[model samples]
Target: MRKIYVIGIGAGDPDHLTLQAAKAIGRTNVFFLIDKGEAKQSLVDLRERIIRAYSHPHKRIVEGRDPDRDRTPADYTGTIADWRHRRSQVFEELISEHLREDEIGAFLVWGDPSLYDSTIAILDEILERGEATFEYEVIPGISSVSALAAKHRVGLNRVGQPFQITTGRRLAEGWPEGVDDVVVMLDAQQAFTAHPEAEIYWGAYVSTEDELLASGRVADVAEEIVKTRAEARERHGWIMDTYLLRRRPTTDD
Candidate 1:
């Protein structure tokens, strides 16, 4: 039987790789890589560096073309579902062809596999089709949310209060009910700008050398954040940022 590992590689820093993750890499016979093109080559380079640092000498790497999707689609949910289905097909083919029975293969995921990542779902989809057969395991790693809070030295939620983790799209829709502390991810719209009263602890490429951090009331720092985010995105041709927005207690509260 074939065995697969869905290993979380943490955010971006090489040091983010855990001992367990390294051990998994060492035991892996083949690594499946999805090429996201030249603009995001840094991601591929980082993975290569880790594989070189910890993988066995006989390890093999197989690359697959990442399926393209609209960055801003009219129907975001449906678009993502379609994109993921296409992506699963790609992974299915890669596993069926490159991975041999009785060998261990891995997909190195960014951040924890159970977060906003789709690797696990894709694997499940492949299995459901009765096509690819394998035993899979998930290895957790530090997420960008964890890295952001650690770098800023702020707790995600104030004592005993709950914090909600949500996407930028939902944050833009409105502040979530009953949660004053909200963590936002995959926010291309700069949704934090909408809440001028909230205090934001923001970081881009957290834990990496090119990391940037900012904090203050959104009213005071929203412009700066917008400008900086634009510049960073332009500089890297892509950006991954996460932030915590803590709304102050209002007079009514």
Candidate 2:
């Protein structure tokens, strides 16, 4: 039977690769990657660095074109479902055409496969379709959530309080009910301002050479963050950021 390994390469930094992740890469017979286009060459280069640092010199590397999706779809949920299915088809074709029986192929995910990444979902769909058969394992790696908090030297959760992790779209509706601590990821719009009273610890390109950090009351640092974020994104063609927002700790607590 063919085998696959879904390995997290970590956020924007080759050094974030764990020993287990390295070992998994070293043992891979083939490394499968999604070509995210030229705008994200930095992402590709970082993935290359990981392979160079570990894998066998002659090991095979396969690149599959990542499916493109409509950024402004009329039906968001429907569009996402269609996009995911498209991606599953692409992955299935890659495995069926390129990977051989008994050979181990691996996909290097951006962060932990179990997080917001879609590799696991696509792979599961491929298996479910029965067009191919393969065994796979998930090797966890450090996520931007961890890297962001680490860079800021802040804890994700406050004492005796539960935190929520959500996206910018959901946050735009309003602050989560009864949640004092919230970690927002994939927020390009700077929605942290919704709670002006909150303190935010934000990081971009975390753990990488272009790392940027900002922490202060949202009202104080929001504009700076927006400016910095825009500059970074316009300069690099993309950005991966995460933030932890907490209702400012008061002496009364």
Top-scoring candidate (TM-score)? 1
lDDT of 1 at 105: 97
Q: All candidates' TM-scores? A: 0.98, 0.96
Where does model 2 exceed 4 Å of error? 249-253
Tell me the RMSD of model 2 versus the true structure: 1.6
Residue range 1-253, candidate 1, lDDT tens digits: 9999999999988899899999999999999999999999889889999999999999999999999999999999999999999999999999999999999999999989999999999999999999889999999999999999999999997776788999999998999998899999999998888889899999998988889999999999999999999999999999999999999753233
Candidate 2 per-residue C-alpha lDDT over 1-253 given as tens digits, one digit per residue, 9 for 90 to 100: 9899999888877888999999989988888888889999888788888998899987888888888999877897999989999989888888888888888899988878888888888888888888799999999989999888888888888777778999887788788887788899989677898788889999998989999999999999999999999999999999988999889544333
Q: Which residue pairs clash within candidate 1?
A: none
lDDT of each: 0.94, 0.87
